[model samples]
Target: MITDPVNRFIEALHCFPALPRVFNPWFSVDPEHDASSLAPTHRIDNLSRYLTERLGRAKVILIAEAPGYQGCHFSGIPMTSERILLGQLTHKGIYPGDVLSGEVTRCSRTDGPVGRRGAKEPTATVVWQAIKTAGLDPRECVLWNAFAFHPFDTDMLTNRKPSSDELRDGLPMLHQLLELFPDAQRVAIGKVSKGILDKLDIPTSAELRHPANGGITAFRTGFAEYVGRL
Candidate 1:
């Protein structure tokens, strides 16, 4: 029996065939890659551990639609990217040493054409910026996704909305995640996330606009308002 919530969550994530490869930072190498590129696995593990630590003190959870190709797809941590993994961004309540242990290069795909490396994800930037702008402590909140995996189009680069079937398949993991934080209030970040919660018959304390496609202002305002009430 797995005693750790983080370990159990990761294990449950692995059980979903429809879920894309979930990366963690503990391993030195990417299991999906041959020997060509150094894996970002360690960075992912560090972030996961950091998240778990934060969850222990969290009063609320912000749930988004899903991970994007340029964000969690590479970092393995939702609402985070390589910049956060490498300790480039200095935000209150987030330290490099807490999430990253040692030096590790970012991972790349050895099987297909190489994509951009170390690129900052726009949505991730916006989300973190909003968090900081709202004066919310990272330790007081947990960030997650309704669908944990990146849903990409045929191009394998462009993001697409997660299908209903995909959301259905991911519901069990979401349920398990909620179980880990029974006392924390849930805040849906977008309509997609809110819809899923509604389907699950879960009541959310608040809802915020997603910080994408020109919704940054609304996202910041809504988030700040919600945090103010907390």
Candidate 2:
């Protein structure tokens, strides 16, 4: 979905670091997990190695702040929120039953029950479900994040919004991700991405009123007319 010779594009990002799943909860990320959330051992040479090995080509790249404290920050998979994983399943091609049935990793975990507060952050299923609703293909969609590593989690345990300086420092990876999907139309998950879009001169829209906002009816009402054009 990006370009001819995907390796070359991945190679150009040789400076980036890749890592094994680091989400053990005891270990910390800094001075260890680089912006790529990868250990020092991982090289730029393996950029396409993981996803290419796992999912395949992704044309659309979804943007998010970073991983949840319990998810990728602990595990190293970008946007690895268990709630979002459930979302992907509910969408066509993937399902909650099949996921819990051991078809997928069964990573779904939530702080609160469904229809209540504290849903898991960005599980793969919710994302895929959103993509399905958006009328897009997962094989054609490449997923990544602004920081790739989660930075903030005090006693609150809520993921911190990355600072402007962090975003400024961490943005090159965003560019690399952009290069990974030349045809992808970027989507901003939260407010911070406006600056990223401004840096790249790409336009973005505001966050839609999410299901958490009782906006599900509006989503069903008008989303089809909007998604791909952005």
In order, candidate lDDTs are 0.68, 0.45
> What TM-score does candidate 1 get on C-alpha atoms?
0.80
Best by TM-score: 1
| Poorly placed runs, candidate 1 (over 4 Å) | 19-44, 90-105, 109-117
Clashes of each: 4, 23
lDDT of 1 by residue, 82-179 (tens): 65666656653334443435554565453433333353677777777777667877667777888767776654445788778887877787888788
TM match of model 2 to true structure: 0.55
Residue-level error in angstroms, candidate 1, position 156 = 3.4
Across 1-230, the per-residue lDDT of candidate 2 in tens digits comes to 44544455444333344333322221332332223334222222122343453234454455666556544442234544333333442434554332222222322222223222113444443454555667754455555666654556453245566666666665676675566556656655544554555665655443433322454555333334445554
Per-candidate Cα RMSD to the true structure, in Å, reads: 4.2, 8.0
Best by lDDT: 1
